[model samples]
Target: MPGERTKYAWRSHILAERALVGAAEHAREAAELATAIEPLAGADDVVCAYVPIRGEPGDLRMLDALCVRNATVLLPVTGEPGPLSWARYEGPDSLRKARFGLLEPTTATLPPDTVATATTVLVPALAVDLRGVRLGRGAGYYDRTLGAVGDGTRLIAVVRDNELVDRLPEEPHDRRMGWAVTPGGGLRELGHELPVSPE
Candidate 1:
């Protein structure tokens, strides 16, 4: 079972990268999809996103879209390796260089407390199984942070379509997500959306 699990994770990562490479339409597709979901989600629903590194999910296109709408976008600022702090996205202009190859808000240097109010959290993972188990870059930061999210917040993981698999290796510290989004493809609920509270 362990061998099978490892195989699935590796396969999912490879397939997802390939899918991303083949889908030239992903950037536009993701923006449009996210735009549609913006209003359906409540204003209190703070969205958490990350500044991409190593050409991962390519969310900058949609990230800019979110900013243009003047939505309250939250970016993950790493505290250590296993925990994260959040900053209210003021604008691309408000972002300044920060530790761990990330961007943070210039004015509001918020702590992890902000994530506690997230209505939706967008995460990056190498693979995500049907059970909503996510494989990050070997970091437990989101797992630790997701635990802090207030009730009613839907934790969503964004991955390339092929990254959504039948199963993946789940560590006790790994966090689960309710929905997974991919470019060109619509949303898929990986599991029962968790009940979250509004701030």
Candidate 2:
């Protein structure tokens, strides 16, 4: 069953991509929902977002919305599997080709302390369980970066509607999400700890 689960999980990238492309409208709605849910995003404060690689959910829309609202956007420069560093996003012109179909920071670079000042982090996830456990792209990037937010930070998992399931297979090092955002639905809080309900 574990092998089967892994197979299904691997295929989720494509399946979720279809879901996201089909529900592009929901992406926009989710963006608006984000602005409404976190009015602080509209402020001049900085929010970190990923240059969406696969069809995870809400890539440019989220970043563009934040920037359009006058919020400073910070993107991660993928380093080793440890804590992440932040670089200033200078609009669309600063993006450049990178591995894993992702975009990298080419314009400005910020210190680690500045990234620690981020109020929000838009993390990419495969499937997030009700217990807040997030199954990422198997890269463990987010798991390492979650702690980089310092204290009192909010990490929102961006995924498709179906991707937020009742449970996900958990590993010890896996990190949890404070909140989740999807298109079809608004935002949901996974603040409290919930059991994984082992299959």
Q: How far is candidate 1 from the true structure (C-alpha RMSD, Å)?
A: 6.8
Q: List model 2 lDDT by residue over 1-199, tens digit each.
A: 1323652564565365555465566556556645543554867577888776555556566677777778888898766566667787877788988766778889666655565777887787776767787777667666776766665777778777767776666778876788888766657888565555689
| lDDT string, candidate 1, 1-199, tens digits | 2326574557565655655553456555556556644543444446788766544555566566666655678887766665687777766787788876776777655777788766678787777777898877655677777888765777777776666777676677666888887654556788743455598
Candidate 2 lDDT score at position 146: 71
lDDT (C-alpha, whole model) for all candidates: 0.68, 0.69
RMSD of each: 6.8, 3.9
Q: Top TM-score: which candidate number?
A: 2
Pairs in steric clash, model 1: 151-196, 151-197, 152-195, 152-196, 152-197, 153-196
Clashes of 2: 0
Count of clashes in candidate 1: 6
Model 1 misplaced stretches (Cα beyond 4 Å): 1-3, 7-42, 68-70, 192-199
